[model samples]
Target: MSDFVARRPIWSLVILVAVALLLWLVFSVWTPGMEAAFGRKRVFLSALFNGITLGALYFLVASGFTLIFGLMRNVNLAHGSLYLFGGYLGYSIGELTGSWLVALLVAFVVVGLVGVLMQVFLFRWMEGQDLRQTLVTIGLSIIFADLLLWSYGGDTFQVTTPDWLSGPVTLPLAVALRSNGEAVLMTYPLVRIAILVGAIVLGVLMWLALNRTRVGMLVRAGVDDRDMLSATGVRVQLVFVMVFAFGAGLAGLAGVVGGTFQSLQPGEDTRILLSSLVVVIVGGMGSIPGAAVGALIVGLAEQFGSVYMPTYAVMLTFVIMVVVLAIRPQGLAARR
Candidate 1:
């Protein structure tokens, strides 16, 4: 029991459960009259679901950011650019093919390839040169942002949820809740559920891939000591390139997934990137669980802030970030 308590993995699980419980308690108290006003319990439930969905999307982007930053020590100012470009590509592809799934896949692969090429052509050369790489990537971000603005004309574009997911799902608990002083509310958008499911699935897959797979082992080893791995005859450069590519691919996938729910414009990239950076910083660099925790907190804060305090919603994330950092500069789950 003591060994288990001391283990990071076990503590991580405990933290997750604690956070979930806290969220449940907070929402239940804050909206005690929700059922009376809305005539349904699903409204409050959906808000929690919505928070998870948003967190899932943030996890996708922030996971990538964490990985890249952890291994390469690159701040990756261009990450947001990749995200924007992915949305544009996915939108364009969907417009042509009229299939959202195909567009998502195409966007992931294309953006991933771009990441690999970027590493190969630019980052690889600047390895060990942190300042130069940061400046160069910042320049690249500006260039990409300007090009996207010029091409897309700053217009907001929407990605339609598939027909199958267009309607609501009457959750299993809808009818059961009526007996517990809760009102019946059955209809909930299926798309939102899908997003939540997808994000959870992705998070699990990422964890397994990182913990149980050979590639993941290489990644962990690389993060710990790239020089040692290279000295051991591992193709460290190739691994770095692949890691960067995978990270970028995850970001692109997020863009495509999130774009379905919210319209994308040229400016959204910056908005999301800033949020993602906050998530990364608050969560702790290179920690997947940290990213999830940070993202959920940020997401819920955004949701609640928007509903109850619209003006503070914008500043809410930064405020939390500052508090967290002040208390723990290494982040809430900082390993170092």
Candidate 2:
């Protein structure tokens, strides 16, 4: 399979081009139907913006998941729990202190501490035991969920954003109205744009860390061959523990960002976790760039699907996963 991919790399390029053309055709033919369904041509711009914002959030969450899995091969099912917990904690702190920035900082630190504790108390003992790791993390997730439900109740909550980020920003670009009226300028929540910018910055930083730093070299080496890394006298366990904590911190930060824009509820943990799983599977298990691409695809599919095929929107992600897997089981950027 690797040889085939290497020899005929253009095949992947061809597939991508075909997919783009198909999407263009579908959207072109269906634009009128969409405007009719939504009663506005602005829905196109709205959906596109929403998709990009949502994809940014997904990338933040999935990047952490991929990092942990790529380095330690640990399926941290409790990751979503950490996300919800972080949001709830942030909410509590923000309400108490009346400071969103404080809440965000505290949430990241607290969740990172929890991650470190979980690694020390639970995962460290079960090294190389995939089944045990999975079961334990699942159990922990259930426990965290129940605890959160009991304490926070099932009601949805949204974190308060800073004053500077509360309003919408109008874009310089505008779209023509379906009624042949004057073009309307699009506006989006400033917070959403912040999230997108944050994701991009985080992606670049992560890329640099992985490619330009010694720690990143160790991480990549560990992902490729843990036994060899350990044999080289690197403190593999310590490195993994730090990686897990960092990943968990990222998840916690994403939770707070997401909760600020969307509502946080009882099932968000599972939903985000599932979304992360889909992203990593489609993007390539450990590839940062792959995660970003997968997140964008999933985000766009979700937004467009909800508008055009509301009845089947939920199934769209699964369909994408299936299609991607059929074409490239190892994912879009799996290591060769």
Candidate 3:
């Protein structure tokens, strides 16, 4: 018998599918009303939509985090502050201009600039000093949280979804039925679909830019070896700043969408930051697909867990992370 054989990507995908089917089967038995509830088709579709939208938001936030960690090798504890700040900025801008497009653009630019400034002023000095940088970012996160609390109060604020997206719109997947002898229907939010589509397009574009573009080539080279890239005449410092700014910009975009999709509040900074950190760890530092996959699992797990076991919802994330780490200390998709 051959000791080694070439394995195709399809094999991995098949395994994944098999595992998913098995999980569904197990849940069907262990959790009553699950499969039946989902069998309604509308509820299942709704959950699928929710998962996709949530996953997109996670990817937007985690991509930049993965990027920065890949390039600068920093944990960026303050990324959540950037997210909160971006949400606040977007809200303010939208209120002033009454245009979601303008608000989104302004938010991205403003947050990206902040990222650039941080790189120039604080991170530049702290390069190669991971501990000091980590502490500084932690302090910054605390300051930002406190400032937001003082300025915005602890109340959660919902962003204004554009008029077109404000109300529940009829969707193809929506199903109508009778509830307790009364007519009822399941509806899908148009905005959620938009978020899912936007996230997918952005993810694809990002993948292309990172893998195909000249700047992306430099970035990849830098990731493999900053020293060698620098020695070979690439301006590694400049790349670092650009990558940092890009990552921060993505986080800002996530914040804006998150604000509208859910709500923004003072303490959300920590929550999102922690979630992003967990995502990075489970996905493996610096892995894009890993981040996406990990984020989907974390997001869906939390969402579903909240419905099933509210008390365990919070711990479920950390628990999963711990188990994944225990099994593959480097993470699920860790390349190294």
Candidate 1: lDDT of 319?
95
Estimate TM-scores for all models.
0.88, 0.89, 0.87
Go through the candidates in order and give the C-alpha RMSD of each one to the true structure.
3.7, 3.6, 4.4
- TM-score of predicted model 2? 0.89
Superior candidate under TM-score, 2 versus 3: 2
Q: Top lDDT: which candidate number? A: 2
Q: Per-residue lDDT of 1-336 in model 3, one digit per residue for the tens? A: 022124456656786798798456433322336545545545455555676678789889999999999888888999999999889888888889998878788889889998999888998887888888888888888888888778878778766889887778665332433445443445677888788888889889888988999998999888888889999998888999999999999888788899998999987888888998998889898988888888888887777666657799889999999999998888887778
Question: Can you give the lDDT of residue 234 in candidate 1?
Answer: 88
lDDT of 1 by residue, 125-222 (tens): 98999899999889988998999899989788887677887987876444224446774545667887788788888889988998999989988888
Over 4 Å off, model 1: 1-43, 174-183
Among these predictions, the greatest TM-score belongs to 2
Residue pairs in candidate 3 whose N, alpha carbon or C atoms collide under 3 angstroms = none
The Cα local distance difference test for each model comes to 0.83, 0.88, 0.81
* Candidate achieving higher TM-score, 1 or 2: 2
Task: After the best TM-score superposition of candidate 2, give how far the Cα of residue 35 lies from its true spot, in angstroms.
Answer: 5.4
lDDT of 3 at 320: 94
